[model samples]
Target: MTPTIPTRQPCPPGACICERERLVEIQGADLRILYLTRQEEKRLLDRLESLSSLSDLEHMQRRMFEQLGLRVTIVPSLNEVRSMRGIGINIDELPGLCRKTRQAIPAAIRRGLEKRPEIAYELLNANDLLRDA
Candidate 1:
């Protein structure tokens, strides 16, 4: 019996060859993930609505992208993440990421406190805030 080889599909019409190349390059970069808090998401949405100047909007987007530990040049904004998803990258894995992070939090917190006691204080304060609410 012979094994079948999968065929490569031709690029879609009107799509830039450079974009496919860019996606190939991005797949190799260190995966930087962001799980934004509700407050941060609200702030970004507000900024998205309020920014009228192109330069200002671009600046804010770059800042937000960097804050999320993503490459600003490769991913200029959250909107670009959605665009990447449309192109077939499996980036919508936040829920899975969150589940894994939650499972590892105890060990992470222990290591973090040993390295920096400030993290312990911050964690307690965060817990208190959540508990109070």
Candidate 2:
């Protein structure tokens, strides 16, 4: 058995923030992962409704492609991560890009303090969101 950590600090979403980017290079599938503080996460959802693209994964897909293997980014704003365009040389390098892309947001949200299933609809599944595929 292990002891539970006790602190006022909010728990992390405990997952990567996989927001796929636009089909910019078309080399291979691209993916971006990011880190966020709980405070930032809360503020993001609070201001979420203000963003039209917030609910649409397709619109955010472009960003994700650029953000593969990301670090030091905020979950809410997706700030401070380098783009994969420079890091990735070809499609094969982005192994499982599609799979990672799917788990990014919903998993992050699940680890969050609250999970909004209503607005989270688009965040749920790629089949439902990316119909053009």
Model 1 CA lDDT for position 123: 35
TM match of model 1 to true structure: 0.29
What lDDT score is found at residue 71 in candidate 2? 22
Which candidate tops TM-score? 1
Q: Write one digit per residue (lDDT tens) for candidate 2, span 1-133.
A: 9985331232234343222233323465332222333444445334432333334433333443454442212232123212221111122233222334233343443333133433333332322433443
- What's the lDDT for all of these models? 0.36, 0.33
Off by over 4 Å in 1: 1-35, 71-133
How many steric overlaps does candidate 1 have? 0
Residue lDDT tens for model 1, 101-123:
32332333233334454433343
Model 2, C-alpha of 104: deviation from truth (Å): 7.4
* Candidate 1 Cα lDDT to native: 0.36
Q: After superposition on all CA atoms, how large is the RMSD of candidate 1? A: 18.9
